[model samples]
Target: MSGITRRSGLLLGGAALLSAAAGAPDRPWAEWDVAVIGAGVTGLSAARNLADHGLRVVVLEARDRIGGQLYTDHGFTSVPVELGAGLIHGAAASTWELVDWAGAETVRVRSEPRAAPGTSVDGAAPPREDESAADYLRRLGVPESDWPPVSDENEPLSRWSAAWMVERGEFDWWSAPRADFRVVGGYDRLLAPLAYGLRIDLGRRVRAVRWSGGGVELVVSGPGGTERVRARRCVATLPIRVLRAADVAFDPPLPAAHRDAIAALDATDAVKLLMEFDRPVLPADADTLAWDGDLDVWSVSRLSPTAPEVVSVWAAGEAARALLALPEDDRFDAGLRALGEAAGQAPPDPVRRTTHDWTRDPHSRGAYLYVPPGAHDAPAALAAPVGGVLFFAGEATTGENTVEGAYDSGYDATDGLLADL
Candidate 1:
């Protein structure tokens, strides 16, 4: 297929069965059994399920790509590199189902180092009662010199409650330490199959959704011009940040409860910087190196045993914001400097550098959603359907903030829609 055309939009594999209702360009509105907004994993999952049930499903995406945050760039290195989500957090994660179906190869990542509960960073005494992780670090006499310059603005680990710290420590030691896995091919390989046999129109930015009556109407703008689509029910899988930003107007507006939930949910700021080197700077066995400096954390792994040397540096929260504020070249230089410092030598000259700042990306204003201290119920509220006309599904709605969560939320939204019908 060439691409989505204005005259006749690109259709999924089985779209021919619904052509009578969808292919009429002269019609005022393109009709469908269901219209899905956003071509991310959630939307695609919903579309696939609905299409399998004989529903005429049309998925509209604002971006040219389909994966959304599941982006994997094969051209970045000799081996595929993920610019968005890279890890399958657990064996039972729904992502693994897709991986199996796609026959994609996966490699388990080395376990992360763990700190025992009440353990001191500098071999000092145990933490005091109710001491936060940051406070514990300080009590251990861990030098402030170890942290990045933006550490002052960053939320101190010490702010975390004791219960939260204990849970994190246990999870790090038992669950997350060595259970992570990466798709040898790229996340796209696993996700792309979900769009099969569905109509997916790329570059269709939904500008407005007017659902005042028995059905919903969508005003979509694309490269060619504006078009309106109508459907009995609509599934909106837009990211939390996008919804919070009111990027797409909703007619009659969302209910106060939904609005409140949207307002309560927070999207985290994050940046991933990928650099390729002419030679290894760190030990070949080194899989991860965490810095107390501006870089925050750097995960070093060869894309493949023999692939080009690459390292992925990640920063979140305020550190990410600070990093993003610098010019691109400056950020690259900072990453190089941090890597060199960690390697205890001047790092080899990097052959290439790339980064994706989720905070600045229009489609995804932030990395993922999180609930504030008192807004634990926000995800449930956000996931609730509005009068059966609008359905919500995303990582935020699922409260999991993982690819598997997004996929499952899509199914949950579809199930809700079917039950209503």
Candidate 2:
């Protein structure tokens, strides 16, 4: 496969599936029909689907908590605020079905335009409308047009850039033909149901997997001693960046082509900062503030629909990288200024605030994966199963690279498992 169109990635990743694990073992080794690594929505969904198919399963999660990025700071507000994977992205039948089963509501939230670098913060700012990010970069002397080639290495970047451009223009990425929705209480609700009964071993970081010939064996360690799992199949629902680090080894090792694809995929480190105001500072009509500053964009979160008092500030690409590099105080100060510039006033002291630094996270290492310019086939290639027993699934494995896409990829992996079974 050469390059996959962004649309293809979205469709390919959205497959449905089922679950199951084989008979139990005697001692030393525990046997399962399938062992799922990572407990995020994709992993949990895959496991749940497998279980539905009468497969016994176990989920091993590195984090002490079950939800990977669907973190909600309950005390932050009366309603839940998502620190990760909050938006539903698209309202697919499967997503809505899961949301309904999980008993969650969808809130309509729109992203304000990202201010171009060097954009004026004065009231005489650019009009609120669709603008090309590439054009903005061209205006700023940023060489965005040259980097992401039309080859395999930079394909995702090219697609992401295209989608990003579409977002800035008179269209929504998923809503051009089909509109999307976000989880009102946050995506945590989406993961809640999937994780209901499955036995998730938290803090159990998988160290290695040996899946060359016989059944797959995974070496996982935690506060307790190292435990090994032998299963008929293993679905690795971890981010590709984690796999690239080789933090977890493979017995026969990933195939050279898979290794190349893994190496080719890029993690666009991103950050989202939450800034509370003494009161709502944005005008009723103004949902976003794009400024020429260290921060890229700021928007009113309306986290709790009724309150509309608090808002979230977000940064991406180089802008997010700059914030991540800042000292704690400087980072907060720069964020405040960006908020002030966008709201047209200095933001009041925050009662509560925090930043989600995806760059610093060990497991994720970054937010989502973006195929550079020319390297589009990597996602599909990454999705290709290894040794039949070793399967891969995650935001990086799918074309959509969104919450819905993640779930779809999980289901698709389960489908693959069922096919081989």
Candidate 3:
């Protein structure tokens, strides 16, 4: 109480959780039964699972909204246009099982895994030719022999290389590729059902959690006021970037190994721009296109063939960040340019355009986590439990890094916590 003081603060937007100066415990401190930070798919799933089992749980979401990155532009389209997660990835039982549980609409679009025949790397009108992802990589700098053999030694990668990978019973990049489905209204719908009875503080921005003592105490500040919440344990589902920033001060500091993993597995900044055309500019038959540029891929989603008036463009990686840095008018112009370039036709100017600058958002420091080429195992370390109380779970924790993976991690973390208790 000697160091506690009232401080002035500011709130920028819906999900921007900001904090003012504060003096909290720097030494080992209390713990919580469970403190789930973040409210994205992962945090939501973890909190829901824990609460379902009759455990005391509280989900602290830095953003004003619950769904962290499952941003579906329902306002723009009747059929939800996904700005964050677009695919279920594979025909696996877990993700599909969640879909069934959620009771969301499902659609089976033929997976167009191959780059359009003659999909030109040179930015030509037509695509280059039929080629496997491996061939595409080989054409770059990767050696064919260097690739993990398509065998037991590399089951998933091998299966991904199979021609029938996209077809049923064949594995793609993931172990079991399911028919890609979009949550009918929006991915946000998926959040509602899971969060039914969970206790979540929408505007609470957790600044620090000290857990060196018997329990955990979190300093959560928001527009209303700042308060300390206590629990026997805490599960941090905050993005890796937030942890890397040392935003939440730990009592005795994190272990050097955990610190190293957090630094190594820090999330990369990814951007997504959704543009809705007055009329379909690209062929519906072209489900997705993986371009060779600062951008990774783009897909055409005219969910209702009868409604050819709308489609969304998705940009990832450095391209997305670059797009966010541009002026608003320039952003729109650049998207239109990319559309025309991809379709080899004049693209209709968008009737509506929406962009999310997640990088600039304080709550979520980056898009979904990505493991670079080497740090494959680093993610597991970042997720490992600390002192049987301080647990970590999020997109970065799971290797798949999909919505399902995030959900599974939360659920798994909750299960792990309950078992330990």
Candidate 4:
């Protein structure tokens, strides 16, 4: 049992297989030791780890490209502009390891002006597990000035879980004055190393996952035609939103607990944009402008001072939904208006406007994970496998709901799969 590259000696009753259908019997069937779904952070890391350990793993990605939420718009500006996730949560974030291994440049920079620490309203007692942070804040009549940042966590207070806040420990560590770091060139640079030597099939969507005691059979659809893939073990790493949307059906249906976990967790709606300006915008002294407006504006230059003269706008949940509601052209206009208001400058319109609405995206229906009310254990429950044949990995399953958590998910899934084998 030193390694498992083929099913010759390690055939566990049935061999892993990929067979083309739709009158293509002449096509060859590809075999794999394990099949990983959705080439996001979780999927990429898991595939890389499993491959390195001598397992013939194949990553089936729904999207045309990998790096799921770690999307970078290199064409938007001179330096890469992050359309999905930007900052590495904190220096302590485990993604830094990949950055180091990839030899990517990063610096501890300020994303916004440092505000008073903690989301606690008037030093109120910690929130109960049954309530949301919004309800708690509203009950305290939290000052309107502090309403915007919710004392500094990314997701708005309404979507937050009061108990989850306590569980996350420190929000200040994620972003404060120079508390976090951004990859200098692009966060997506790590994609190369993770994808290197990995067998990835892009533009292929897994429509169904039929798992039983024998093995897991995945029905996949692509431009070519319909195909079926059978593997001894399966790693499903789709985003929570995609899972909730029922994009892929499990033949016998996932266990009740897994299904419940998928439903219980909340995914935040997110929209990001980059507006190129003639010169630097926002006050030079200010790293981020915490405004009373609906969006937050940050300097792309801060990622690398010499990078570009553009500002990045971020909108979450209702705000993101609102922006998404606007026409494609109007969305950028709205972003510019929000930026001008936040910056207190009636500056001219941007030269270029690049807007990406994650909420409206089919693949990424929302940004990342968040805990609300009483579903604290949902992440772990969702991460749990079924029949020892199907494993799961994603940020929602990690309990932390961060890039680090998503990356760690791969390790966790691979470890479990290895042990079972």
Candidate 5:
């Protein structure tokens, strides 16, 4: 009880198990079977799957709202705005099931993938065992004009592992781009079914995790105060930056494998700049465009023909850092200038503009992890369970750097956890 005083706390926000900080250990939390940290799609999917198997699962989330990096901005414009992950990357993406369940409207993004479907990397030879995406593009003889879209999307693709791309089925972007889509109702609607009947504790920021073969303990702090929660097993779906920042400590230290994997991945400086245009900016048939600069401009109307003429400009790496460093008043101008430059004309000023710098947000350290070349196996190593007590699931755990990848990781971790037990 002596050490418990300094860290004494009670579970906060929605989970009704623990009653008081001092007496929480002896309370109803003892009945909890699993503790899932971070209520993003990864945690939600795991919790949902566990509950379906008749397990008592409690989800602890740091933010007041759900969706870690998959936030939808309803107030940004008359139509839903995606500040985070926006597209379903492939026809085989697992998110389509959730989309159907949510009944969300979606439209195919206009793209001529590799000139036709079922081709092999635009008909070029397969990437070598140790090839980078940048090299692959060069090998394909992709025109410099066409490289902007791919280059701007993944700045410094010299770090993108070609094998990792094949594993993620992302080579299809050039091999098959017609399958991408945007959710008109927003990606958040898929949460309803994933979260049904789950006891999610929002605002519970887990600061430390202490686990052993006996069970696992988590020290979480929230608005009310701090508290400890115990469960037979735990799943941590924290973002790569959060773990790398050591925001949450692990008792006895994590193994060298996890530590090395942690160092292998890093967060990209990513930002989304949304501006409302009086009229369309890109060509009528164009679904997306890469400006001369590092920004990729696309009309929101592609999500729905009736959607407003708002165009969202996306930038990553150096461009995002530049945009984030700009003064509040100058950022929008930079986006407008990029669009105007790419479209070859300066149009009327945007009626309104909105931009969110997730890089600067404390709750979310950054957007997500990007796998550097030669470290393609980092996600698998990071996800490897520790002492049969701690499991990790996030966008980083999956080879992909997208929401669907995150969603797949959630259930994948759940399947692994079930097998472990």
Candidate 6:
């Protein structure tokens, strides 16, 4: 099958299913060929692919909106400001394909500044073999007093895999500059297409999944009330943080191997603080800045060439936790102060400011997944299907921990389900 309209696919698939169950006893709940949990990139891509194959699929999203981490806040500024996932990463990324399909305008960020020979950031010595980048920097004769207040204490160096870095087009953590890109309208423009012609039920929080029987049953709480949904196959695309937290109980509980995979992986914190200025306040020459202070990275960019000036402050790992611990208004103030200090200019505060603490979001819990030391195969293990009844797909399962990986994992899940069927 090529492309199927939402109405046509629903009508045809429903009629076929009813005909097949004509002689069976009437069931209280509605049945679906496939039930996808979470309307993120992974779930939406899987639902779209399965629907294209003539399967009746329904996506249940706990959030009120469709694009999960691909959220764009129009209220903050006249131009769309991304509160979640922002950059497209690289040209090879699958997100670029969607951008091309949508004909969205994109701007490739300037590459990172190259380090001089035999030196790291701030003229520090290069990393040694088998040494973590963080430890190597600490040992590079840099004074302890010069170090940023936020140390990389809880963050592990092994989390930064070479393959992952390469995929992101970054050759070295301290030196190699990566070329990043962003969508003109918003990252949601690329995601909105994948959700087209697919049944997505927003504000549907999945509380439990009972899959011991022939079919899978899902207990979902939504705006109306709690309801049970039955499906022959179920694809669970919940974030690793949510899964690790055991937010949704599974009947017969997952096997020891699955549980082990969930425990082995790590979900790190990341917070994006967006500040919109009434006028251009940041330096035009610098598109991005990596500070050696409280704020790890500060990126300044425009929604369009002529759009209002906006600065995004990103903090990861322990720094993220520190910022997330503060109250919402305090967090914004801290970020604004940091931006001004870094730019060496007092930022004009005539406009709006916003931020999203992914670590605090109930549905996601954390930003994304990371492969912990000695858990190289954890992603594949987590992605593996359980008794052909429960399938898993997410950024963690893909091992890429990117929007592209999440989108690709959906196709991977659909292929696996189709093979089983």
RMSD of each: 8.2, 9.2, 12.6, 7.6, 8.9, 7.6
Error of 5 at 139 (Å): 9.3
Candidate 6 lDDT over residue span 183-204, tens digit each: 7777788765576556788899
Better of 1 and 4 by TM-score: 4
Count of backbone clashes for each model? Answer: 9, 26, 24, 0, 3, 0
lDDT of each: 0.71, 0.64, 0.61, 0.73, 0.75, 0.71
TM-scores, all models, native as reference: 0.80, 0.77, 0.75, 0.84, 0.84, 0.80
Q: Looking at candidate 5, what is the lDDT of residue 377?
A: 76
Which residue segments of model 5 deviate by more than 4 Å? 1-30, 114-150, 166-174, 278-285, 302-307
Error of 4 at 201 (Å): 0.8
Query: Which candidate leads the pack in lDDT?
Result: 5
Tens-place lDDT per residue, model 4, 281-361, is 788776688787778778776554565578888777678778888888888888888888988887677888787767778
Candidate 2 deviant stretches above 4 angstroms:
1-29, 91-94, 110-180, 285-287, 290-308
What clash count does candidate 3 reach? 24
Q: By TM-score, highest first, what's the ranking?
A: 4, 5, 6, 1, 2, 3
State residue 399's C-alpha deviation in candidate 4, in Å.
Answer: 3.9
Query: lDDT by residue for model 3 over 280-396, one digit each (tens)?
Result: 676667555444444433543556676545544555555666777889788777777766666777677777777777777777777656444334456678778888878888766
Q: What TM-score does model 4 achieve against the real structure?
A: 0.84
Output the lDDT of residue 300, model 2. 35
TM-score, cand. 6: 0.80
The local distance difference test score of model 2 is 0.64
The predicted structure with the larger TM-score, 5 or 6, is 5
lDDT of 3 at 234: 86
Expressed as tens digits, the lDDT of each residue in 339-389 for candidate 2 is 889778877877777777777888888777665433455667878888778
- Provide the global lDDT of candidate 5 against the true structure: 0.75
